[model samples]
Target: MTKKTLAFVVYPGISLLEFVGSRTLLGIILAQEGSPLKLGVDYELVVVGERIEEIPTDTPLSILPQKTFADVARPDALVVIGGGADTLLALEDTNLISYVRGAGECASWVAATSTGSLLLAAAGLLEGRLATTHWAYADRLQAYNVRYQATETSNTVTDGKFTTTAGASGAVDMALHLGAQLTNQATAQFGQLMIEYDPHPPFGRLDWTSFDQQRAILTPLMNRRPDRQDTVQDIAFLLYPGLTVFDLVGPLQVFSALHRIAPEFRLIVVAEQAGPVMTDIGVRMVPNCTFADLPHPDVFFVPGGTTPTLQAMSNPAIRQYIRSAAQHAQWIISVCTGALLLAAVGLLEGREVTTHWSFPRYLKDLGARYVQKRWTVNGNIVSAAGVSAGVDMALYLVSRLRNEETAHTVQWLIQYDPQPPFGGIDYQHLKLLPRCMRGIFTFVAPLYTTKARRLTRQERGRPPYDV
Candidate 1:
């Protein structure tokens, strides 16, 4: 039987997710979900150039070959990986440009990830086309006159034969989506389950409608972080001063005690103003209660999203006001990078704090003296790992505030059983990720360290801002 060919455009600085994700999914489908028997699907990564030439894979050691436009086998489809450096943006390779336009003119389908859409736009295939990429690259794509939807994730745009996804590993989603289309739902669902694609965000479905009220406070914050600009990394590292999860189905399921009681605690969303809070998932959240309208609660949580009101943090008057008010609040907890604000206000300092494990080393270097723990408690200040960690932290907080019985019951009511399909090693492809991302971590370390010390020094009345 003649097999359909899948050619992935592998360029420099392309996201590992796009290449690895798409390729892995195809391989999984063709290989038939770990079974001894095999299915049949032929997928290939063909980098475009003058002729067949070697292109750098996501990892430094791996090199994917480029197929010349003249001899390149007309693929059943094309998937262009993005997050490439600026050079790829200009697209000087006429062979690539020619091949894209020619193939797109002849082939039935074309797709792109993140900035890879720029290539489509460059090829003149996406003009007047509806597409999407990473939120950070929306404006860049818009400049090319491509219609943009900022909310799409992994791989999820299906505009006729031209599919586009926000690449960062979204290529994986695109891969699965393609596999599902080519094969069956069972394959796709099995793949999602196999890799534990399920998410347990502490916040609800994040979006503008959900966080409707907080738009007033959030718009400005979002404006300040148009690129996201490694804000989480910047915040975490500066606060940690590097830092750094898991599938635990052990005898003591972490929150097993919480599965036995009813929860009395209520959720309160605050903004120093009345309204919704935008979550990091590119959506806004409206908590059960608003802070301006509700009475001071026994526990306060700042969910990890974007940074809270810079006005709240930046203004000398507002900062002073919050410092005074927080003194009376029973518990002040920041999940994920939200601790950056807490520390900035002199709350988390002098107290051991914990956040998601991504920045453990940085946090300690920044003055947060602690090790790799899921939850960290320094008196009334509690911190947890990344977004999902909040579920456990929330239960733990319930247990401590109310009782173990209450926390346990709430856990049971919610059925908080986590079965990460990837298990103990979910995100273990360390070397496969692009250097740009790793460099973001490397660059952020010293920068945050400098910032943390400066903040400390300012508090100490030293040189005004140097620790």
Candidate 2:
């Protein structure tokens, strides 16, 4: 069978969540176990950029596209991602709009996520079509002669050939729907399961009573661009293959907003070597620099993963770097099981820390005091409970570093207001499960330790494990 190509348009200052979430779901077919579908065989996924150069995102991390607009002019499916002010700026780029218009016109499927629908409208593709975008910008669609749909209840809206989504989180829902259309419901469901797409927001559903009030307050701030400050403080994030993207992206997004308002706060992602690192999801991320490039930073950040994180605990080089970096960093932060990595390096000894609810015993075994909270701070060390908790912790960190007003501004910019479809986790009911899970980790620890030790002796040319 001839491979059908799906091209995702990427640009400067694009929202990472919208791009990553949609791409991860759509591309999961390649990673589905026992599936006949294969990359370059049944399907192909390409990141289409205006140029092949590294493009900055709304977050501190930048992305390197696999192809340029000139290289892949038209794909089977075209997905245009969105952003904040940068997206508004993208509408003015004649070259970009031309490419989107031409490619979108020819593609079998055309889709936009978050504010990306605005780009489709700018490209003159959504005229007389029903569309939706991030609620903040819903009113802007009518200017281009497009009928705007309220995304308050539905994350996605499809009008003929065009598919538009509400917010960054809606990208996942849109991708699943599109995936089902292109392949089968079974394929989409399998992909969703692979990524564990269950939604459980810590807070209850969002109240839409004040949509106009929020729109009025945030519209001007979205348009306002603060002058860059000369004074700088380096904030570094550690990157590794098989790590959870949300663990890093959640905090990174928060800090990115901080950087937007206060240029003095510089954000950087570092790895053992600089290049593409495949995430826990099927998506790939390219770090900004190498660990050796920035040995010491004002703030040192670490993200967590599943089995890979356990294996990382045994890597001597990683352990050494963390120990050395922690000595010099003014603040040390970990999200989810990243606390286990810090604990592995002996930096969390006697310190009150929190990690993913499932891994508190591991932290305690590694000689750290476990605190059951969304996030905890002890001296210069800070840790968050799990993946989503990183955002909450990061917002608090911003308040500490700058002020509550500054943090609040960043919160509003990202629409951090939580409105989970289902209420927060009921820990009381699951109390017995944690006790059972704690014992399982004891046996799981030594197995990964042995695997890591074996990996250390292997040739350095190959990756530690398949991402």
Candidate 3:
């Protein structure tokens, strides 16, 4: 097999996380067993900068280049790291830009992260395509007249051969997309799977029953399942439980917010069980599930979490009960892991969907596509990842149910503004950043509040960036 070369080009004031984030993705993809891009086989990570001596890393540690931009062979993929506000011009050195111009002609993919796109734009890499960066530098980056729209979606933009990310976290999505392009879906899946895509709530999580796929596995609890019809105007979650604090609050609240602005389409938030739900931050909420017991509503909503109670709902009988209720419900919607329960009941087979990235394993184990995207709408079904993401997805859903005018208003209300105060790009790895900007805007932000993984002996000392 022809070996693939990945050249990570670094410069002064580079955002360290974006730089390391790119390499980490390529590293993770190669680390998986039997993956097409195996360690020591398909790819090699090369950090290239201008200096002949050791370079300063974005973090406190120092970084050494595998090769200099003035010397390395042309690569299959060329990645430019994000730089600081002032470094955009500092990185405008002719030697590096010359190499990039040549790579632009030879490399299969040209990727940039954060303000790194500014480098490419400076080198004339993004002449005609839409590009983005951290919203702050975005003003400066766009000063060059590049079309810069404020988009809060996931990364990996492909314009012919150029790819760019919005900001720091987007680097992961960009690299994964590049991985998919270099390899294949299954190869990409292999790497994603090795990252433990199967999600079990720290509390535990699940997927589906069996065929008679669409057949009911049990009796409906009330008048709702009396049996079918309606193409599905919209699906609203009408429950107090099974919602992640964010999803439970964000999606429903945002959807309601949209209605408050414009009332073209109808919305319903129902519940099978009634009570108060404590959100992720301890916020309390009382739901409107009375319809779940009345005439079967056209749309169905399953909230996230419900982790503590998912086991009870996992039964075939309960699955059948939900299946029967859904028989009349036009669309089934779940935000985050709530989609898994829908899948477990056989409602999401072969359907395009999404749940939070954190719930990858749950999405994968159920054979659901836990895409890094916010929302994936398949006919009759729509699912969203995380609670915050649910707002994005729901707004999209609201647009489809209502209109673009309404969606635009909702987007503005939420301030869908994403200029991170401390961009995470600087915290990724030592090798990726220039020493100049260390500690200014650190990525890999402090850590998740809770311990993400419980590593076994086999995993001891192994890198945990995958978590």
Candidate 4:
């Protein structure tokens, strides 16, 4: 098979999820270690735009293009992104439309997601093709002599070499389809499993009839972020063996919420390798990017797990990556005992931080001033107390990065208002528990540190490879 160049056409105010999700899913398939085909060997990936510059999106984040229209005169497959309705309507670049038409002539497959299909329509490539845009833009999609089709279960419509998908989530499905076309169904299935793409919503499907309720819930977030000049921050979350899922995902949920509103923040989950890493509780998480891929991040985040974190400190590569990334990072944040990793790398030296209540003394031993607060911030270093506290820290970070208004908007969207069934965490309430239950808590409390210490001591006398 011939080597193909997969290109993404990026623009200002484009939907980050639509663009990133498709590319990431495809990347996972291409870059899956041990696969017969490799990224640079079997295929080349490129992000193209009108110019080779950073394009700001509707969210707080900005995307950097790898190639310009002049550079990538033709690509085997191209992805044109879609954005807000008004933003898409305002985009009337003759040069861009002309390039799209010219590129489509030689491209084997031309695809668009959401309003991005409109660009293809505007370029006259969709004149006789059957396509689909976001459901809201179905009528407008027909204006270019394209047949607009909709289905309840599926979101993609493909005709010949042209494929268009509805909404942001449809990007994944479309990418999966493309993956199979590029490689094989088995490889695509493996990619899906690596990312754990199975969706299981807790509250079930939304009622389409309840338009008023749905509109009230979605309107604030659906509106385009007002234009502003800001820098994009690349945030990297460190993942390793035996990590606690909630420790990483807690703050991530908050950040993901903020990302929808203000995308100035980009989150990249990084690990030693490119594939799945198992957590302390046996849950597996696949890191989308690797340490080498994203070396210098603006924000370096670590989530704590007891056994793995201690083991991670002994690994020279983990220590080196954290140290190197820290040199360029504007902020270093941690959740739970993740503070230990930062401390291990000497980034937390003499800094005021916090950790899980069970390990405050351990944090103090590492030269950090342990404060018993929901979260602690000293200069550019921030630490959250245990797993649940990550959300508070993330919300606070959002406020610092953008504004209280933006943070509040994210908070409202996620419905962060807490109404815990057990009246929330309190040291006093612990004494009220039954003696039998207290025994169990006591047994579990020191398990993490004890196991970690054992591993550390065992490696003390041995050479690096003796393990």
Clashing pairs in model 4, backbone N/Cα/C closer than 3 A: 59-263, 60-262, 60-263, 60-264, 61-263, 61-264, 82-116, 242-280, 304-338
lDDT of each residue in 276-343, candidate 2, tens digit only? 88787555678987778877788988988888888788766676567667767889999889998888
Per model, state how many residue pairs clash.
40, 0, 29, 9
Give lDDT: candidate 2, residue 365: 67
Q: Rate the local accuracy (lDDT) of all candidates.
A: 0.48, 0.76, 0.53, 0.67
Residue 404, candidate 3: Cα error in Å is: 34
Clash count for candidate 4 is 9
Runs off by more than 4 Å, candidate 1? 33-62, 66-73, 84-90, 152-155, 199-467
For candidate 4, which ten residues in a row score worst on lDDT? 415-424
Distance from true position, residue 94, model 4, in Å?
2.1
Error of 1 at 12 (Å): 2.1
Positional deviation of residue 144's Cα in model 2 after best superposition, in angstroms: 1.3
Clash pairs detected, candidate 2: none
TM-score of each: 0.42, 0.76, 0.42, 0.54
Off by over 4 Å in 4: 31-41, 86-90, 209-221, 224-467
Candidate 3 residue lDDT tens string, 240-329: 443344444445545544544444334554454555543332223344444435345566667565343244234333344455557677
Winner on TM-score (2 vs 3): 2
How big is the RMSD of model 2?
6.4
Top candidate on TM-score is: 2
Evaluation by TM-score, superior candidate among 1 and 2: 2
lDDT of 1 by residue, 172-247 (tens): 5566676677667555544553333444423222333533353343334321312322221100111110111111
